[model samples]
Target: MNFVCDRVAVTDAVGIVQKAVASRSTLPVLEGILIKASEGRVVLTGNDLEIGIECVIAADVSAPGKVVVNSNLFGTAVRKMTGDTITVKMLPNNAVSIKCGNSEIKLNGINAEEFPEIPKFETEFDIVLSQREFKSLIRHTIFAVGTNEAKLILTGCLLEASGNNVNMVAVDGFRLALKKVVTEESSVSGYFGDVSLVIPAKTLRELNNIIVDRDDKIIIKCSQKNVRFEFDNVVFTSRLLEGDFIEYKKIIPTEFKTKITADLKSLIEAVDRASIIITNEINKSPLIMKISGGEIRILCETGAGAVDEVVPVEMTGADIEIGFNNKYLLEALKAAEGDRVNLDFIGPINPCLITPYEGDDFKFIVLPVRLRTDVSMDV
Candidate 1:
């Protein structure tokens, strides 16, 4: 494509689309970015079969055409350019020339026709949410998405939109994270019901990185197999995972026998200190919490060392002792929005539910680690 574009704008667009470029693909074109110059604008697209990202930037299009250039080479060339504007042109024999100031770089370009097309969806529903809200939703829930390939469904987070509410749920067998928010707007075609999509966590994570925290709204369009996110001058599309997500609602316990209101920062700090004794993953130790009266005692004993700390809390119901993976509990606590949080415990073996002191915007369920009483083990 022949286009003269603002160097900064093109550099930003290249950086955004490069996230979707296939790092190691059998198809050479998939490793390159498709640039389409048309009518005063340049469109850049990157697709890796699973997720695709497109960015549009205003440019002076001298000759409207399209070309596929290596993403790394083109991006680096444009970013290092010292001029205010960059000139890109298609040369003979599928070669692309980039010029800025005195620097010129020529790259072998693949025919645009070889690049795979991003899926076009006949959208059945659309949900509108603020950039800040959507970004927060992904950050809160993505940590719990499963990494196991055997359970494919758990690898993605469930996205549900109904009424004016949007909910995201993720589970990794050991823990579950749920975040709900009120949407700016939601609409659907007559044939479709409320939007229910299991979006791959990886796609959402990438989208989160691109999204800025603003009051500006993001439009999400959902189809049968794919979902599209449109905001500003960018469009993001991803193939949805095919399978039934876990019924997370049923998995969350409604009743608890023990509840404690603890300072979120304090609890997190205590957990962090206790986990310091766990030097390696091979023999990692759990953070043990003994809650009673108005205080909670944190303890950890590992082959490396032992830690003992305390965090005062407001407790009710029966006192309980619980053990949990240090990382899991710390992540859940960090994801919480408020300063104080409530932790609900069913017993030592059951899951621990964490929620904010006030609103129900988020909920986290972390399963307790079972402590083994071995003769050689010390508490």
Candidate 2:
């Protein structure tokens, strides 16, 4: 491959594709980035057998060819190149030469033929949504995706589409998070009436990073087996997890014994402070919430000491006390949107449901932790 591309373009392309380069792999080809130059455009591709990313960069290609270069080395060289533009030329013996300004570097390139072929889809795009909306859904629920590999399906976020509405749901057995949004239009048509996909959290996180400006649009195409995301000049493909996601609808509590509305920022701050000393203990202690007299008091006791903070809240129905794993609560709070959030409690032992005070677009549920014997509650 021989191409003259802007230094910034090369650097960005390498950076984008490197996200898919396998960090530890038995196959060396999976550790390299494929560079294809043809018809005045240069394409970069990387695949680790799970997810693959390919993007095109505008370049002047005097010679059309393809080469596989070490992702780590090529990425570093592109970033450290000392010129506004760089020329990449594939030498005769599978060696590659990079020239930038007065600097010269040569590296052995892998044979492109050895790289695994990334999956390709033939169907038309099934769903179209704004990049901002797609990103919002991911950020809201990705944290709840189960990291436990044994529970296979829970390791991914469930993506479902019906008519013009799209929903992303994730759970880690201990907690559940749901983010729903309606697109301006959708072309989702299938035999099941609705399309469902379980996309791994790792893929969604990378997709989130690539969707740059909010104004951009994303075209999503999915089959029974794989899904494709096309945006900008990049195409992303991932294998879908097999099997149905847990019947999550039955998991959300429909009724509450007590509902408390509190300032989102204030509640987060109080919980964060209360959790400061509750770390790495064998007890795996929880932060306590006592709701009474229109106020919520957060307290935590640990080997270090105790923290107690009170934040005013608007409460109705009944007063309640609850226990929750501080880490899970903090993650959900950080992912939640808006200035005010509502917490619904059925009882001290039931899951605590959290949602925006004004809308149902986002909902989070964290199962309560056991109230430790050493801690006393005023309930």
Candidate 3:
């Protein structure tokens, strides 16, 4: 392919498409990027046989052609070029020449025929969401996705769209994170009666990186086997994990023995300070949160040292003392988007629930570490 394009535009498109480039693969062609020049545009595509991204950059195409070049080489060359515009020309024997300003480089590229084509889905989307809302949902719950791949289904977030709302749920056995948002936008097709899919956490995270603004709209459509997300000049698609996600809704507690609203920043700071004495992960100590006397005290003690700090809070219902993984508490606090957080507890043994102060925007259920009975272990 022969084309001349603005450097910024080409670089941006390259960066977006290269996100899907295979770092290590058995197939050599899959490690490269497919460049197709036609109809006044150059389409850059990268695929690892699972997730694929295609980005288009407008170019002055003198000849309609295609080539597969090393993603790393092409991206590095384009990034280093100081010229405002770049020209790419395909040569005999699959050799490609690139030039910009005083810089000239030649790269041996693979035959475009070897590049695998990304599977296609329907052109129309089933549902649309505000980019801001979609991104927020992913951030609020993506962290809890299970790390163990044996349970393939738990490695992805469960995306559910029903009625007037869209919900995202992720679980890692230790904790469950759920984020829900209401949208008034209607699907063009009346097909999505109830749609649920397990989308890989990596896919959702990469999708989040591509989205630039809240004003931009994201078009979402899914088939039995794959899910597609389209927005801006980018198209992202991923294969769905086949299995039923855990029935998380049924496990959330209905009532609580102790419920309290605490300043989010204060609690987070206290938790951070209390974790200082957790010397090692092998024998890490848990932080004890004692709620009473109009304050919550976070205490952590190990053979190395101890940390104790009190943060003022407002409590209702009853007094309670709960032990928790300091790391889990900090993660939930970091995910919380509001100034105040509401904590609901059934008992020391039951999981603790954290929510945004007012609305149902976010819900986090964290399993507690059993409190110690020995005097040396108890705070």
Candidate 4:
């Protein structure tokens, strides 16, 4: 393959596809990126069986050919090169030469025929949404996905579509995050139906990074087996996990005994500071939150020391004291966009539901830690 392209465009495409390249795979071809140059465009693809990414760059193509080159080496060399243009040419000895400015590097290349072919969906149900909206939804929920391999389904995010709305949910047994947005149109022809598919969190995160700044609308096409995301010059495909997502709504409490509103920045900083001291203990010490009389106090203690912060809040219902992992709380709080956030606690042991005071679309449920009474206590 021979093509000349902008360094920035090639670098971005390489970085994105590299995310899907297998780091340690028995199949050597899976570790390399497949480059297809034809019809005045260059296509880059990387796949590790579960997830695959394809990116197209507008290039001046002199020859039509395809080759697979080591993704890591290619990405590193391209990034280090100083030039506005990158020229890649396939040689007769099954090797590829990358030339930029005064530097030229020759790398061993594999036959494109040996690369695994990614499946293409024939019949697809499509949904349309802006890049920012889709990216935000993934970021808000992907962090809560389970990482355990044993629970394969939990490691993926649930994508459900009904009528004109799409919802994404992720949980790791201990916590759950659900985010939804309404769209004006959907090409999915059904009776306001919902398709529940578990998409790997890693794929979702990678997709988010690639489409972060893309303002154009994205087309999400899905079959029963794989999900495809297509935009300007990129296409992402991920294998769907075959399993029923736990009925997450059943676990979310409908009501709460106490609801408190506090500044998101203040709460995040307090929890972060408390976590520093709490990590010293054996049991992974938890942060305690006591809400009473228009004030909320957060406390945590360990072998090193303890920290306490009091922040004023607008609260109602009975007073409640709760314990939770400071890290979990901080993550949920980081998703809070507004200055004030509302926390709903049913009891000291039950999961706490957090949301922005005026927004009802995003919800975060964090399971509380078992309160330890041995610590120095203050009400």
Candidate 5:
């Protein structure tokens, strides 16, 4: 392949496609990036079986051809070269030469025929969402996804589309985060039919990073086994998990014994400071929250020391005490937007629910740690 391209355009395309390159794989071709020059554009592709990314950039093509080169080496060379224009030419015997300014580098290229075929988005069940809104939704819920391989479905975030609304949910068994937003255009007729699908968290995160322009719109296409995201000049594809997602509504509580409303920033800071002490302990120390009489107190103790912070709250119903993992509380609080947060507690054993003051669209559920009173144990 022979093509001349600007440095900025090539760099951006290389960086995006590199996300799909496998760090360690049994097949050597999986580690390299496929470069195809055709018509008036150059396409860069990377894949690791589960996920694939392809980016196309405008290039002045002299010959139409394709080749595979080591991704790391090519990316490094292109980034360090000082010039506005870069020229790549394919030579005989599977070799490619890249020239820029006064420097030239020769890289061993593999036959493009050996590269795996990346899936294409053939069916059309498209949805349009602003880049900023979709990116924000992923940031709010992707953190709660489970990393344990045993729960394969939990490792992905659930995406459900209906009417003009879209919702993303992630759960790690201990905590759950749900983010919902209304799209400008409604193309949900075929996207979800009537239910949600589990999408791998890693794929959503990759999409978030690559989508840099806020005003741009993203086209999402879903099929029975895979989903595709197209934006700007890149295409992202991932295989969906093959299992039934948990009926999350059943686990959410319907009633609460106590409800406390407090500033989101204050609560987050209090839990963050408490986590410092709780995290130092050999055993996972639980942070205890006691709410009563217009005040909420947070406490944490460990081998090093203890910390207690009290914040005023608007309380209703009776007093309640709940223990939870400090890290989970911190993450949930961070996801919450707006000035005030509502904490709904159901007895001492049931999970606590956290939501923004006037929003039922976003909800967070956290499982409570078994208190010392429930089971006698040494501390």
Candidate 6:
């Protein structure tokens, strides 16, 4: 394999594909990046069985061949190289030579045939949406994906489609986040009705980094077992979780006993301040919210200190007090959009539901933490 490519362009492409390179694997091939040189371009691919990322960049290819090299060594070497162009050549015995300006390095390479083949989908169904919209869908709900491996299904976010409307939902055991958007157009052709998929959070996070906030369209192709995302000379594919996702509709509360409307930024600031006292002792300190008299008072007591804060709000239904894990409440509030947000409470013990004050585009539910008897709520 012999290829000469722009230093910056190849470095960026290498970084992009390296996200899928296995950090720790028994098979050495899984930790290597495959480089394929063709007529006028070079393709780099990294796959770790669960997810695979491929990037193509323009290059001058003197010889058409392929080689696999350690992703970590190649990425670091390419990034640190000094010059406008980089030349790569595969020598005898699978040894690879890399040269950029005055720097030169010979990296041991694996035969390209050893790399695992990325699955090719037969394109059963597909959906189209702008990169901005797709990124928003992932960022809005990815925080709520469960980390517990026992319930493997909860580790991924659910993507459900009906007509042109799409809903992305993520739920941990303690909280749930839902984002709704309308696609430019909808396609669920191979299926009888709606199409649902559970996509792993790790894959979505990497994809979010790859897709920029642009109006350019992105194509999502789905098959029986794998899903592929094609955008900007890059293809990202991942296997869908096999089990059924939780029934999210049943989990969201329909009726509420209390409703409070507050400025989103102000509420976040208040909670953030309350969290400071218990930042080191999160398990022992619970942020307390006392809702009454058209005002929401925040209180927290911990081994370090205590915090008493007040933020005005518009309230109706009934006055209530609730306790919550500081981190969970803050994360939901940070993810919420719009200048103001509405909080609907079923009671002090039930989950607190949060939504935008104006639109029904998003909903977040955070379960309340049970306050310990020793902690006093004085505000």
Clashes of each: 0, 0, 0, 0, 0, 0
For all predictions, the C-alpha RMSD in Å is 2.4, 2.5, 2.4, 3.0, 2.1, 2.8
lDDT value, candidate 1, whole model: 0.90
Q: Candidate 3 at 124: error in angstroms?
A: 9.1
lDDT order of candidates, top first: 6, 1, 2, 3, 5, 4
Q: State every prediction's TM-score relative to the real structure.
A: 0.96, 0.95, 0.95, 0.92, 0.95, 0.94
Best by lDDT: 6
Q: What is the lDDT of residue 70 in candidate 3?
A: 90
Candidate 1's residue-wise lDDT over 22-53, tens digit each?
A: 88778899999999999999999999888999
Give candidate 2's error at residue 19 in angstroms: 0.1
Using TM-score as the yardstick, the better of models 1 and 6 is: 1
lDDT of 3 at 233: 89
Local accuracy of candidate 2 as per-residue lDDT tens digits, 106-185: 98988888888898767533777889989998999999999999999999999988888899999999999999998877
> What TM-score does candidate 5 get on C-alpha atoms?
0.95
lDDT of each: 0.90, 0.89, 0.87, 0.86, 0.86, 0.91
Clashing residue pairs for model 3:
none
After TM-score superposition, the amount by which residue 178's alpha carbon in candidate 4 deviates from its true location, in angstroms, is 0.9
Q: Tell me the spans in candidate 6 whose CA falls farther than 4 Å from its real position.
A: 187-192, 279-282, 372-379
Error of 2 at 59 (Å): 1.8
Q: Is candidate 1 or candidate 4 better by TM-score?
A: 1
